[model samples]
Target: MDRIRRRRTGAVAGTLTALALAVTGLFAGGTGTAAADTRAVPQHAVTGYWQNFDNGAQVQKLGDVQDDYDIIAVAFADATGTPGQVTFNLDSAGLGGYTVDQFKADIKAKQAAGKSVIISVGGEKGAVAVDDAASASAFADSVYALMREYGFDGVDIDLENGLDSTYMTQALKSLAGKAGSGLVLTMAPQTIDMQSPSNEYFKTALAVKDILTVVNMQYYNSGSMLGCDGKVYSQGTVDFLTGLACIQLENGLAPSQVGIGVPASPQAAGGGYVFPDVVNNALDCLAKGTGCGSFKPSKTYPDIRGAMTWSTNWDAGAGSAWSKAVGPHVHDLP
Candidate 1:
């Protein structure tokens, strides 16, 4: 992926929407002109991933927070972007046996507990629901209704592996219809510019930046192996930066829409792994002598929003240390 890629953290500070989104607030239906507003303002709601785990029992466990991150993405394989092999059952990971009532209740509980959990669909897992566009639309309709039924603040289309724009666009549109003007719709895709990412993920996102909140570009690793190492490596600083820059520059992705996240396993983790990208990035930063547990703005791209790690459980002092750097990147984003 692009070495010019990125990551960072912080509380939903005061300055976030204050600078960039102010015009939208004033011109956005002409609601207010003199009040400094703040309260669940989905304005640049920077995201970080929580890979897999339902009910917050996994890494997002109720009492396991080592530190605070801006956004928490809950893994729901059913909502995944896996190719065209998805079905109504989806991947069983997202819907599982949990009904809409049960799931939404969980979301409400998490938010009440001071944590923001967004539903993440599409991943290395198996959530693809069939290649047919109709099927995809149906799937999106169901998920969109579910988001409403469950009261989720937003949805994420993490086509980490499957699906395409045709279906993805339908799905996003479905979610947005039910969500209306207040809900969020995001997509996470690889930085390598593809023709169509996640059912027109790029085009649709640009077309509807108002609803499509974040376009998290996987920067650390993407495409194929560096050789036969069978392991993924972080793109050098220049490659990463340029790659991500290309994504935003051409895709019509807003500076706020573009996001950076950690891929688990400093090496390759396609199998079954649950850990934060902090350790991996930190280790690489250490080897590169850039020093781990730090966040820096891209000299060329300062409109960056937020950074995310694959997993969250602090493995060692390294993971905890990286958490400390989250605030600087998130709060100081341009």
Candidate 2:
């Protein structure tokens, strides 16, 4: 997909303001009432991205999403006329007459069923920028607005364009302040973005580790990269999954915050599409240190968060084989 060449470009901005906000305590304090209302996520949960726009995949309303997914991230919230701000527009006409009310209702029903429905900010084509304090604030405000309007649990950062760790950290902290501790913040960085702790995306994830939920690093579409072992590993294999995940686990992220993200079907991504058993094996290998391919972690991470897929719609097009097998397997991780 030429993802590497499409990196987001721009110089970092609003550094002084970001630091000022932090020093003046503008980032402190959240709504206590909202904390009590936060939805509790499972220790071992499966996350799936729900496509808001049809792309040759099965079209589904929010309610049509299966129960196997613990977290349903609405594929994308579009970049607005204002930089760093985003908004959602349900493709009612495209979704076969699904209305805004029905979409909102479906989100509520999913939450009522103990599932979290959040808005994902970016995708392969996402370009929303939060490189400064004003933009950062805009990002938080608009996303929170969407949260209120649609009953979303929180936000997901899938900004494939690029990210500024400094302002993004501030934006999320401001978001947590308004949304409370219950805010479910997740990130879906490309595999290369997470290969090092010093990367902007990795730094942002660590900067907000307290409120951050899981970092489901995309393990496909990437050719080969260095694992925690400092050796090169190719994608679409058990070693590729566990070996790369080791980099995050061994770094600043907690065992509970790491997840293995893969394509739900061959059509879901350009490359690195493995069968469901490979995903399960990688999970078992990481959690139990068994069922491993070539690479194994130095120690087992029984508390490892779980798995994530590109799109739930693709899984449905393939008879739900990805979720049918991977969903139960993720929940069963020990």
Candidate 3:
């Protein structure tokens, strides 16, 4: 999301990587069991990011996040000194004095309640790259270790600056092979990164669509981009959401694999923040061919996956206005 900072920091240049996950069903007794071979396919999703640090918005325990959220992605893991190596720099200091064990326990509680807690790689200024097979293998191996050690359900790719589709695809395939069917592979590419099917991000998404869970393209912090209709749509409007999402839906991506990602509050992004109603309207227009704005999709994507937000912490600061309003609407969509 922070393209400017990534350019100036020089951390974004390196390449190498790996990541993967395994299913552990949360048992009632604070213990975990092997995940069911067939888990419920999520028809509607409400995904939120949990920043490990306190950033003005009230930091929350992983379990304290609202139950409405189906998937909770931890903000980031710092790309380390080795290419494809990363580390989660968490501690009692940033967690309001809660220890790492307590944090892991809370993550378990959420998982027990049928919610997923995955590690998100990258952010406004994440410095991770997977540009070759060696780096790709390293990235997968490191991520798999993290998922095993921390009990994460999966990994979320949110690389902000850019990606190499060739190697990223290889890294993701390796990750999927290790994690198996229970792994939830999601992405949060910036708007420009996903502007068209020809883009690297889109190509990567397509390359891994079989293993991919969803592609929540960030619709915030973007100025303007061309829609499927070839007309430019400015962000922060209903037209922008529908028009842009149309590109993915009309392309190779199944409706269920596409989600519209937005900021939980105006403060969550530099620009392109719209009211929750605008988001719901876009959903309705895309999935039901109703509640449309000026630019409506030529075909309805009735099974499109639900919405995603930048951070649940910001939503909490705004009295959870975004989730409270949009979560139920997504659930009700037919």
User: What is the full ranking by lDDT, best candidate first?
Assistant: 2, 3, 1
- Per-model CA lDDT versus the true structure: 0.44, 0.82, 0.78
RMSD to truth, every model: 11.9, 8.1, 9.7
Instruction: Name model 3 segments beyond 4 Å from true.
Output: 1-41
lDDT of each residue in 215-259, candidate 1, tens digit only:
665554443211111112234342343333333533345455555
Give a tens-digit lDDT track for model 2, residues 36-145: 22465898889998888767889888888878999999978998999899999888888898989889889889999999999999887878999999999999999999
- 2 or 3, greater by lDDT: 2
Clashes of each: 32, 1, 7
Query: lDDT score of model 3?
Result: 0.78
Give me candidate 3's TM-score against the actual structure: 0.88
For model 1, give the RMSD to the true fold: 11.9
Report the C-alpha lDDT of model 3 over 185-205, residue by residue, as the tens digit: 789988777665667998998
TM-score of each: 0.60, 0.89, 0.88
Ranking 1 against 2 by TM-score, winner: 2
- Relative to the true structure, candidate 1 reaches a TM of 0.60
Considering every candidate listed, which one attains the maximal TM-score? 2
